[model samples]
Structure formats: C-alpha cells, structure tokens
Target: MDLLRVRAARPAATGAVLAAAALLAGPAAVAQGDSTTQSDSTSPGTTQAGSGWNDDAYRGEVEVIPGDDETADMVSGVVFEDADRSSTHDDGEKGVAGVQVSNGRDVVTTDSEGRYELPLEDGMDVFVTQPRGYQVPVDEDNVAQFAYTHMPQGSPELEYGGLEPTGPAPEALNFPLEKDMGAKHPHQSCVIGGDVQTYDEDEVEYARAGAFSDLAARKDYSSCGALFIGDVVGDDLALYDSVRELSGMLNGPARFLPGNHDLDFDAESREHSVDTFRAQLGPQYYSYDVGKLHVVALNSIEYPVGDGYNGALGERQLEWLRRDIAEVPEGRAIVLATHIPLLDFADQGSDVHQVDEVAEIYEILEGREVITVGGHTHSIENLRAGDSLTGWEETFGVEELPFTHLTAGAISGDWFSGEMLEEGYPTAIQRDGGVPGVITLEARGEHLTERFTARGDDGSTQMSLGLNTPAYRDWFAAHEDDAGEAPEFESPLEVPQEDLGEAWLTANFWMGGTGSTVEVSLDGGEPVEAERTQQMQGEGQRVGAEHSDPTAVQQQLVHGGSIADRSMHLWRLDLPEDLASGTHSAEVTATDVHGDEFTDTVEFEVID
Candidate 1:
C-alpha cells in the first residue's frame, strides 16, 4: 500500500545527484530551523575534550543527550582512536569536525568539546565515527561496542521489538576509550543479505516461516552480526517492527542499510531521506570492524532537492566514507553493503539507479581488499573474478566478484505474488530462476567463500529446473480458455536415471495459469508432479505491478511478458531424486482444469 514510484525512464547521467532526487523520496529531510538542543549540564554527566581548541591538536570527546521536543532524544558520541591506537589521528580515524548528528532530520554536533547534544527519537540509534586511534566497546556478543543505549523505556512493542535486552535506558551512555590492543585476529563472520522486502504481513510471515526461521536457528553469527542490504519492506514501513522482532531471534547483533524502497516516501530533503529507517534500524550508513574485515554500509539513494541527483554517495556521506575507510589498514579486507548494485546488471546503460560514484568509491579503497553486496535488482548475479559488464568504467568493473559482488535476490521474490504454497507463501517464480534466499560468507583470514541457501533447500546448492520456452507452447494453447488454466503436459521429462543430475524442474510455462501442476515420471513409474507453491524467486516483471502497455513501448524494461496473462506464468519442479552417473530420461505432464492433459519428454546425460 505504501509503494514508492520508480522512475518510468532512465536518467541521462547516473552520477547526477538530481537523478536520485527525481526518483524517490524518503524520511530524512533536512530541517529548516536550528536543531533542538539538550544540555547534559542539567544532569551531571562525564565530559572529555582534547586540548588546543583552535590549534591543530589531537582531541576527542563523548556525550549523551536525552530525547526532546524539536528532535528525538539521541545518545551519540565518537571514537578518536586510530587503527594502531597511538592516540594520534591516522588516515581513517581522523575526526570529522562539525559533522552533524541526528535521530533523523533534526541535527546537532560536538563543539570544541568533541561533545554533541540532542534529544533521541523513539527507536533512534546514535553512533559516531571511530576517530582514528580509539575503539568503541564491543558487547560480550561482539556487537560493536557503542557509547549509549537510547531506548529509555526499552525497545518498543511489535511483532519483533528492539535488541533483546528490553528495558529502560542504561544509567549513563558512556563509551570507555581504549587503544586497539594487539590481540589475535578476532574470529568473526557477518551475514550479508540483500533485500528482505516483505510487502505485507503475510510476506513477513513467509520470511519468518522460512529462511529467517533457519537463520534464527543458527547460533554461529552470535559474534559478528547480520547485515541486511536494503528494501527492508516491499513498501510497508510498518514491517520494520516485525523485522526487528525477527532479528531479535538472531544470536548476534543485526544491522540494516537503506535501499530505494526503504526511502520514506514523504521525505522532503536529503537529510530526512532515511529518517524512519534510521529510527528503526540505526544509522543509514555506518562502518564497523570485525575480525580482519572493516565493513562499511553506505546509503546509496540520493534525494537531491536542488541540483540533479545521481546514484553516487551524497557529498557529505562520501566525505565521511573517505574518512571511514581511510582509517583501516590497507591489508584489511573491506565489505561494502548497499541496496542498489554499483554496477549495471539486467539494464546496463541506465543511470537512474546505479551508483554514480563507483570510481570515487573505488579510489578510496584502491589498494585495499574490498567486496560489495547489493539487492535492488531482485535477481542473483555473481560477478566472478575477471567478469566485467557494460557501462562500468573499465577500471571499476574489470575485477571478478572480488570477494563476490553478489546481487542478492529479493526476499519478496517477484513481488510476493504467484501460486500459494502450503507454507502460506506464494511460489513467486523469478525470471532468471534463482529462488528467494540468503547468502552466507565464511571469512577465515583474507579468504572468504560465499554460499547461497535457498528457502526450502536448506544448505543445498541452488538448482532450479531450467524450463525453456518451447515446452510450454503446446501446454498453454491446450488450456487457453480455462479459468484455472494449466499446461496439458505430462509428468517427468523422461531421462536416464544417471543423467537426471541435481536439477530442479523449473517449468517456465509461459501459459500455465494459477493452480497448474506439472508431474514428472521416470521410465514407466508413477508421476511425481512437482508441487505448485508460490515463492518469490528471480528477476523480471512480476504478474501484478502496473507496467506501461507493451504496445506503447518499443522495448520492455523487464524480460518476459506479463504474468497476468495465463500464457505468461512460469513454474519450477525440483528433480525428486538425485541422478546416478549415466543417461536418463524424464516424462513430464500437465493437467488442465477441463481435465485436458498434455505430455512431453526430454533426455540428458549425467557424468559421475
């Protein structure tokens, strides 16, 4: 119901900030009046600032501000320690003097005290850049140590609430300063996922009932945390509470990055662009360190009001990013998480949504080991080592998925529409055949291996039935008139048992209507019709969203035709049994509503 409008056409320059402003509005609007201020002096609180206010002197400070009228209460502070903890400002930990802090649009900052004051917003998160040498505290759980907890009355109520330790605000929000003690490289891992955009309560339930449930069951990530890359909800901000509740199930800390859909539609300026997102999910963009990795989450959505917007990082955020990444050791591997992919995928020439500052971001980490993850496309693409796509300046796109630049498929998969499965979720088939799921990365030292887990398959390698179009033509015409139309195809495209391999029959039956089933058989065996369940998967135009009439446009934005047509549906069937080494044949059949039936056969070979 809260859908934000995506631009119908692509912008001329992807780097223009105005392009982003023209596309979508979010919550973090820059405020017109001076920010609301709160004095910590009213209640005695610790204050620390460095010497030589005007002179170039290494200085640092911390403060806690309560929630108030003009702005929400915020307990924000910064760390001035550099990587070596020498108490000297280094490359990446340089303090960003006069940087504005806020719960949302209302902003404030530290003065000569390196101390800032402001009332926290409900569910607001306050964090400061770790000034070069100092490090913030890490909870026993290894959640990045923070300066304060602003949930005065604990986390708010919802399906999923705030962090597990629900209660009033802590006595004093203080971050003890300490040098980064030379310790063993922390054995840490962070779960990176793209687009958990739940459209409605049902989709939320689907997420809860599926991959999320699986994630909650694992205690492995109790150390580092889970970082979701954007589109938290399809269009519904209300789902944030539910998402938080689900995250509460995690064994470790959970953080979020803003995507296009996460934008507050009512947001008026760049500052207020991600207000609700920040309030519920912490900073829109922030950096943290874990083990040997320096993870930086960036806000890619540009909400330019005056000048044209581009897909690059906002000027302010970019400046902060330079400072943030500069502090890390050149040897440390950095992971950048955002919602939109920095490079083009299905659409290469369009600039309406790709990051314009790709080169700038690249320059910042020119020599450092870096990997990036994004989601907005709702399809899975692996930019392996040496892979390069069009539109990306050669220097920027040539590297293989250096550490895996994964375009995580959306959680809502094709917009949460399709055949309803027993799981009470739609079997939303993706155009590319990748199913809805999450990605897990195992990082030991500088080496990281990426694994994708589909919703129903657990940890099995994602394999879908690569259904070609020809097979569906006969099936569609057979049931063209039936209300509950389906392909008149037979079960199991017969294949020698050995050639079956580990293939899931993803029937791309362009004509199969709702409730269609495709049963498969081996040799002369009974048919095992792969169940028709609705789950979101892949990329391309989903069945329901409004699109410009195909006749009106010479080119279609998404591949494939509309799913609304009975002839436009695609289905998938997982091979019931693993294939042995050799040749095999499968017989597939489809049943139509009028009792009509159609059959087909396909053969293949599988080697041991």
Candidate 2:
C-alpha cells in the first residue's frame, strides 16, 4: 500500500498549468496516439490577491492534488503492446480497449489512450478484454500475457499460485497495440469442451483421471489454449482452484466460461450474479482471438440480478459483443462458447434454460463462419449438413452445423454414481450412450472435422445406441421395487458385420422398466442377456433426503437418489468378446410384464 502524497497545485499565469501537471506524473504520461489536450481552470471561490488583481477579479484556483495513492485501485498495469506483431494479444504485450475492465464489482472501460481507473475490492481480479484487432503480449514461450498484478495487502493466498506474484499495481497499466495487417487467413485451431461439473473430490479425481489425464499427456494444444464451455463444477465453487490445477496439466493456456452451476447462488443483481465466478475466474463474457478465430465467451445464464434476468447477455454485454464481433474481419470464424446449449436434444421447449435471443445471436453471426459449443445438456450431439433438431424456431433452423453446434457431455457422466470400472473410475454412462471425452476440432484453413475421443481409449470412431421405447411397458413397471434388475435386453436378428464393420449397437431405450430384460443375438441365434448394472446412469430420480423409513430410503438411494419404479433404459451393446472381426447380424428383443414383447433387428460390423 505505497501511497504518494498529492502535491498542491500552483496558480497558473495562463492555460499552461495543467500541461505542467502531466509532466510531473511521468514521461510515459505523453499521449500515445490520441490528441486530446488538458485545460487549466480555477475554483469559483478562489480570489486573486496579487498586485494587478482585485478581490472579485479572479476565482480561486482549485488545487489538483495527486492523492497520496496515485496508484489505480483496481487495474495496476496494462499490456498495451502486441510484441509479436501478430495484431493479436500475445504473451507479453498490453490489453485492448472497450473491453470490460473490472475489480470484481465495478466495471469500467479504458480511455482513448488505453488508460483506465476503476475501484477495486480488497481481493479482486483486474483483467482486460482482449479486443478483436489487437492482442495482449505473450511470454517468451508464447503464453497469452496477463495484465498488471493488483493484490491488496492481506488478500487470501492462492491455494495454487492464483495470480502471478508480481508486487503492487504499476503506476501506468498501459497496453501496446499494432495495426491489423491486411487480409490473410492464419492457421487456427480452437479447443472446445462441454460440461465438466465435478461434484466432489472423488469426481474431481475422476476428471483428473479421465480426459484431463489424457489432455495432460498430449502436447497438441500447446499453441491453441483450451476453452471449457461452462459447468466447470457441479455447483461447487471450491472446485475452481482444483479445476485450474487440471488446466495446468495441459501444455497450453486454459480459459473458462461461467456455466449455470458456476453462478453465484447468493448473487442479488446482475452485477453480483457472477461475482464469485468473476472473482475466481475472469470476466463473465469476453472475446479473444487466436490466429483467425474470434472467440466470444458469453454468460448465457440470464437470471435476475436486481430487477430482471441475468442469463442472456444483458444490454451492456450484448452491445459489447456486437461491437467486439464487428471488429472481427469478415473472413474470420467466430466461436461462441457458453454453458447451456443454445439448442439441445434434451428439453427443446424449456425457455428458462435455452438461449432466449437465439435469433439475435445468429443474426450477429449470419455472414461469418461461426460455430457454437455448449454443455448444460450432457450429450454428444453433432449437427452436420442438413440436420436440425426439433423445436428450434424457424428463424434459427440451423441447416448446417452452421458452424457446428456441439454439446460436450459431462465429465461426471450421469453424476458419477455408476458401477466402478477396472480403472477405478465410475462407469458414469452418457445419456447419448457415447463415451465421456473431449471433442477436438481439427481446423486446417477453414475446413474443419469433428473428432470424438473417449476418455480411456484412444481417439477412435465412437458409436452408441440411441434407445427409446413404445413397447415393453409392463416389464418396466413390475421390477420397480428391485434395487437392481436386468435391463430389457435386445438381440440383433442379423449381422451387417461384413458391410458395416466396426459399428456398435447403441440401445437408447426410453422406458427401460424396472427389472426388464434386453438381450441380443448375433446370427439370429440364442440371445445372450446383457447385464443391467447401475453405473451412475441418466439424471437419476430426485427424492427427499430425510424420510421416515431410513433403511428403505437407504436401499433406494443408488447414487444420489432412489431409482424410480420405471426409468428409461439407455444402454450400449458391445460386440461379443470372442466374435471374429467381420460383419454380424443380430436380433434384439425386449420382454415386458404380462407376456408382451417388442423386437427389432439391426446389423453391425466388427474389426480387429
């Protein structure tokens, strides 16, 4: 807390007094680019007592005192220079303007000269918005640079070094910039991940052991940082530090967007809704560029701050986004990342969760090649050419991936309560029957390919059953009381192994009644019953914690809640352990109570 005393202002003989004050501040006070000049004036109460002046001839001179604390309360430094000459913020240069600068609560902007002053709380994060045309400086090895350090005395120590230990705020937090070079598409790749809501320490371990572990082992993302699109934690803010540690496991930088669960539960107004998140992470909505891609991370959870909702980007953030995106070159691609899927497979009509102003957002990105990724709905959904999910407003009928709308499944699959695997992690199954993993977008000069890499397995072709049911109604209800019952099994009547090799039957049955059976037979032969094991599956039933019968309640509580009498049966049928590598036809059958039955035949290919 070094405080410099404000010097008394001397009476000016003319308009030159203010210019003198600028000189005393420092040599860096000279305007970098702007031409605005300062003017000198006197207070109304000041009277000239000199020889030539009468009592009422002159107003009192208002002394401008340089407060003993000349240091900015919030932002201590600015990285105004883009040292790499990339016109984008790199490792060591300054930050950009019109970016939302904050000290956790009071947000402000930088002046034309890229100079800003905002009040800061005791322990706050003062970050800049990496504007479109210019980039912040990068370090020696090319890590995106951070602004000045401003940690007040006695701020809590970062469990893992939170902010770099760089002393107090600098006198001038000035960032440098460079002119945007003319048209040329740069090779760019953006990393997109869906929901990573870790509920507890063990689940955090699951995340660490799963995809994150795989991410740690690779070096592919060293140049392009990782962007996690919401659901950083499962409603636990404490996991933020742990999450950061996970990011460190990567060879590149990692940024995050606030998911619904990442929100401050106790936040009252829009200003405060994401206070904790902002404090722990950075800004709620911000834009940055990597190569030719303009990445805009938005806060889509519009809940009430003081008077209205805070989910969608409010007028202020929306305006900022408009301006930010406007600065991006027409040829560049934009990636909008958020938590709740702007469009999703689950809950297509729920207004509270989906992006309300989807059309407006699309309009913002109409002409550009844009892609959106989200994670609230834990499923791996890829909308390729000519595909549109049900319930989307016609205006938002995304004909193509319209820049790929992918829903990254959760790391804690189905809440991490599944049966333990040989690897010691829960078999937390995914809703879409797809394995839990990360989606890597291989972007080589505008052309993009979507690849799904399962957590424990190498990146490979992933196919799972999308089971649903219009049959087997009674069987689902009969075993409703059993704690553990076999899933209604289905046997494949024919094998397409020769024609469609390496394909797995992903049974996405909807009414998998309690205790029902699903068996599959290759070659239209005898059906082998697939075991119905509870690995934390689908959003489990929700029930009251305190009940009259504790024993019965305890038995019913499988992972987080009691399995309802009839739950949807979503299962994946793997090829037989000893089946030869070739095409195989199989018949599947589901037997319900009251001697009723439903059957279907499908073919799949297998390869060694």
| Best candidate, TM-score | 2
TM-score of each: 0.57, 0.58
Residues 1-608 of candidate 1 have per-residue lDDT tens digits of: 01011212111111111111111110111011111111111101111122211132122323332334333233444433334434333455544344334433334554653445555554445565333223444332223334233444543343233333324442233333444321124434457767778877877897787667766655455435578888888657878888877775554556778877776655556655566676566677777666666677888888753544446577767877776665566656677888877764433345756787876776777666666778777666544334344334342443323333557666666566544556655544343444567766545555444445556543422222222222233333344344124422332233344433334444332223333456677555888866543221222223321111111010111112113221122444555456565555555555432223344444444444
Q: Candidate 2's residue-wise lDDT over 1-608, tens digit each?
A: 01111223222111211121121111111111111221222211111122221111111111112223535454443435545454343455544455545443444666654556766543444456555444344332222443333443422333222333334444445444443321112443355777778878888888888778876655454334577888888777888878777765654556778887776555544455555565566556666665556677788887664544333666666666676666676756677778877765454445656677776776777667776777776656553223343345432454333445657666665566544555656655554434467866544444444445566644421222221111212323444454334342232222333423332344332223233466677686788775432221222222221101111111223223233222123433555556676665555555421122344444444543
Model 2 stretches astray by more than 4 angstroms: 1-171, 175-185, 305-311, 384-386, 394-403, 465-608
Cα TM-score of candidate 1: 0.57
- After TM-score superposition, the amount by which residue 594's alpha carbon in candidate 2 deviates from its true location, in angstroms, is 47
Q: Output the lDDT of residue 123, model 2.
A: 42
Return model 1's CA RMSD, one decimal. 18.3
Question: Distance (Å) between predicted and true CA of 585, model 2?
Answer: 4.4
